[model samples]
Target: QHGTPSSPGELAHHATLSFSYLWAGDEWTFTDARGAVTRVRVDPAIHASNGDLLRDLAIAGCGIVMQPEFIVAQELARGRLVPLLADYRTMDLHLHAVYLSRRHLPGK
Candidate 1:
C-alpha cells in the first residue's frame, strides 16, 4: 500500500484496497438476521474527538459504518470496530486517481 514506507525518503510498492457501505449513525440499532434488535450504547465517540471524527461516532455504538479497507484496516485489526452481518450484501464504490495536475507549477 502507499501508506507503507520502505527506506529513508523513498517509497516502495503499492497496493489497492476496497471500500463498501459507509454506515455511520449517532444511534445504532443492531439487529440479527432474524430481525431482532438489541440494546444500544450512549457514549461520546472518541474518534470523533480525534482526527477521524466519524470513526469515533461509529465506535460510540453508532450504526455500523463501512469504509475502505485501506482507510480502516488498522482500526479493524486493532479491534476498535466490529464488522456486522458479513453475509449480507453491502455497498461498494469505484474509485480512481491520477497524478496531481497542478504539479510542477512552482514547487519544483
Candidate 2:
C-alpha cells in the first residue's frame, strides 16, 4: 500500500484514482482541526466512473482513492485499506433524495 500522507504537500508524489465524471478529480479539498481548509492537487493515475472499480484499484495498490466510507468499510475493517491524513477532513460528499408530492399528484 502507498503509505499515508501526513500533510497535503506530500500528496503530489503519489498516484490517485478518481471517480469523477465532471471534473478531472485532480484537486482535493480538506479541512483541518482548526477549521482551516487546504486544497491539494494530486496526479490522477486512473479515472473511472464506478466507485467499485476505484476501490478495487486502491486495494490492488495501484493508487490512493478518496471515496465514501461505505464503499470501503469492509476493506478498512479487514485492514485492507488504511485511512490517511486523519488530521484533515476530506470534502464532504452528499446525496439528496427528491420525491413527488402525493397531495399534488394523481394516484399511481
Candidate 3:
C-alpha cells in the first residue's frame, strides 16, 4: 500500500451531516472527541463540499467521512474500509424528491 491505513484505533472521529437547501452534500472535517481532525483543511485543488468529493477523499486515504450507505455500501461489503465500529454506523441523508413520484410508481 502506498499510504498508511486509516488509524481508527488512534481516535474514532465522527462524521456530521450538513443540511443546506443549496447544497445536498459537503466534505466536512472528521473531528473526533480527542480533537484530532483531518481532511478539513486539505489541498485547495481538491476542495470539495459534496458527496462525490467526500467519497474521493475516503478512497484517496485523505481521511474518513460520513456518507450515505448507497455511496459506500459496495465498498463496505467488499472490505475497502472496514467499519470503524460495527455498532456505530453513521450516514448522511440526501433529501431527494421526484417531480412525479406517483406517476413513476411501479406496479401501480
Candidate that scores best on TM-score: 2
Q: Evaluate residue 20 in candidate 2 and report its C-alpha lDDT on the 0 to 100 scale.
A: 78
Question: Any residue pairs clashing in model 2, and if so which?
Answer: none
TM-score of 1: 0.41
How many Å off is the CA of 22 in candidate 1?
Answer: 13
Query: Which has the higher lDDT value, candidate number 1 or candidate number 3?
Result: 3
lDDT, each prediction: 0.42, 0.86, 0.48
What is model 3's C-alpha RMSD? 8.0
Candidate 3 residue lDDT tens string, 15-103: 32332324423433344555555433212233345766666667766665556677778888887755553333233344677676686
| Candidate 2, residue 31: lDDT | 94
User: Can you give the TM-score per candidate against the true fold?
Assistant: 0.41, 0.84, 0.43
Q: How many collisions between residues are there in candidate 3?
A: 0
Worst 10 residues of 3 by lDDT: 12-21
Best-to-worst TM-score order: 2, 3, 1
Clashes of each: 3, 0, 0
Q: Tens digits of per-residue lDDT for model 1 on 1-108?
A: 144222212111321111122453323334445655543432322223233545555666543344556665778899987654453333344668868788658874
| Lowest summed lDDT window (length 10), candidate 1 | 8-17
What's the CA RMSD for each of the models?
16.2, 2.6, 8.0
